[model samples]
Target: MNTQIQRNYEAAKQIYANLGIDTEKAIVKLKDIKISMHCWQGDDVRGFLNKDQDLTGGISVTGNYPGAARTPEELRQDLEKAYSLIPGKHKLNLHAIYADTDEKIDLDEIEPRHYEKWVQWAKKQGLGLDFNPTCFSHPKSDDGFTLSHPNKEIRDFWIEHCKRARKVGEYFGKETGQPCVTNVWIPDGFKDQPVDRLGPRERLQASLDEVFKEEINPAYNLDAIESKLFGIGSESYVVGSHEFYMGYGLTRNKLICLDAGHFHPTEVVSNKLSALSLFSEGMLLHVSRPVRWDSDHVVTMDDETLAIARELVVHNLISKTHIGLDFFDASINRVAAWVIGTRNMLKALLRAMLEPTESLKEAELRGDYTTRLALMEELKSYPFGAVWDYYCESSNVPVREDWLKEVKDYETNVLLKRD
Candidate 1:
């Protein structure tokens, strides 16, 4: 093994030891699927397809290359290149609304170009594209939507933009075989005092309704609409923040997406499960770990907090969902960053697979918060390294007695056997 591989193995072994896990059996519980920077290894993504050691069926791409293309042809070429890099099983995470340029461009001009390129690209490649659209300010949202300013011009401009994007989405679904994704990770609410942007919630809700009604169709749907509670940098967030919670509560569309790191750490808020509770709603799940519960997206499998989050995914609390390996690294080599990230994510997934099934379902329906929390605590105590020692000790992994009884009690008394 290379130095890094050796180092990782040793580190994992040490973690297992510290957690009182048996090194041999612990390795058996590890297996998962992933795609990452290595998915685009060496910029020759096609080269690594079905060849790289990591898991398969997961890869995402920004629209074409890095810089904005001036024409439809340039966009088409970028799409083609992105397609070439994608595997047959993977979907392309297209950046429909770029942070800088997308906010500025006229929807009328940009939508046609996007539509033409997406249609042609699908024809040539036989694959559908997923969208990542932004909904926030630049020069246009200066006064805010219906929420902040209620200015006719700003809201009208956004209305036009949403209409154009929805048209493009409809065209994409009709021509290509992919569903339209309404990615509204908007930073609309403020962190501090808001002198000018009061009653922002009304504007936001009105805008959402208008956009949905005008742009979206009964059949033309959203695969996953993201709902971020907060944001970093100059961008603000809706949903989780105090100013936005009421608005977020009111705006309940199906198939909402939640970032794992978005919630306050060590809390069982079940942001993923909460999204599912919305009548007939589904979710697109984004998994990333926060350092100190901030946006330090260095997700690792070894993190216990992440393991708890993993329990949610494996138990199928939220189904019909797509996954995003959400990570941003400015300091490391891009390839290395993805490799490390992919590895960590896969490990978490594998551990989740080992999670006990029916009991989890039971916990969900019981409405007993205490029982559910205890069950999660038990699930977390699976004896990462030493099964024997784990059993001998006060660990959660059932050994001598029927551990199923404990699981049953929690399910029956607490959750009332919903499973």
Candidate 2:
């Protein structure tokens, strides 16, 4: 144990204890919480199915940094390196196209066996896995539509793909002993305003109904639907709007995925969490940073992220919320992106847990707004970093920016060689 970390943690622990907060308990809670790390970050969203194809749909990866993983093996290698740098155990969020098998299969033809390698690797790593169906980047979706594509054949193709994705999710949950969240997101909308928006939305609802027709055991797999306000090709109109999924999720008894970057610039997904929690059974959050639109920038310890973590802790929604990262920055080290984003999320959660919420709630309930405001402002100067450092040190991961050296070393020895 580092003497300085121990000293700092002790001093900080006293400060939090004075506020009736338990720093040790916060670390214990943070350790148990898992943030499902997105797999697309390592390879700039280019899965193994067709590496050469241009990214379709509205999303785009801007950077061309050297040594993006070109195969499933390389991606997993990068993920392993990333997991080593971040503290605590977490799960991997896998996209369908990253299927580990060498089979000649398209999106609709995918099966659970295609992801057997990933499940085995996850078991060996003592990690769990979540899944997503690839609704974008396919020829059928080139026209910027998937489940709601006016063409019946195109619609059926995506539906079948989603159906199988659930099975894959089920397989992962059964094997890893942690339920997997199989989320669906589609870029089905038009570039310009269409004469009738209702038809597309109705078709999308029907398609989703058909996709969720098969019931999987809730103990093994959970279904979630993600809604995007607008996307690249569908900037003028997005079929899967937030309201659309909110209604569908409520009626269908599915988890609604509120993506940070998927909403309008003025709309914070954190603000919606508490409201939705009242009615929804559970939610899957896509923690991200958006500059103006859905840029998918690497996450930081920003205000919105803090609010999100605080909301979950204050509302006691941690048990019902599924946290996942959904960002990619090809301009920098990909593995480092994973470590930075994920570490910040965990830190946010820890900070939330360290808050003297019971005292704050009592103040708010008594209409002591001034006290509540003053205490929150005073807490901003608390020794959070010291406890975070001790947590990382105890977990055997590098503290603060010390992890950067490891990433840089991996880049020189591993990533650069791939180029």
The numbered model that scores best in TM-score is 2
Which predicted model would earn the best lDDT?
2
**Which regions of candidate 1 fall more than 4 Å away from where they truly are?**
1-88, 98-108, 115-128, 142-148, 195-198, 215-220, 223-225, 232-252, 266-275, 278-280, 292-298, 302-309, 312-314, 339-347, 356-419
Please write out the lDDT profile of model 2 over residues 1-419, one tens digit for every residue: 99999999999999999998889899999999999999999998889987777888888898888889988889999999999999999999999999987788898999889999999899999999999999988889889988998999999999999999999999999999999999999998888888999999999999999999999998899999999988877878999999999999999899999999998789999999999999997999999999877899989999999999999999999999999999989999899899999999998988888899999999999999999999999988899999999999999999999999998999999999998
Q: Backbone collision count in every prediction? A: 11, 0
Q: What is the per-residue lDDT of model 1 for residues 1-419, given as tens digits with 9 covering 90 to 100?
A: 23543454456556655545445453333312212221222222222111222211112222232233333344344434433322222334444443123234443234645446445655676655455443342445433222234576766666666656666666666666556554544545454455654466667656656666653562544634454444543234342243253234335554565566666566433433544545435555556656645353545765543654464555454244555556544333333334345445544554554454445667677777677777668657653323232322222223323433543443345323222
Query: In model 2, where do residues sit more than 4 Å from their true spots?
Result: none
Model 1 clash tally? Answer: 11
Q: Which 10 consecutive residues of model 2 have the lowest summed lDDT?
A: 50-59
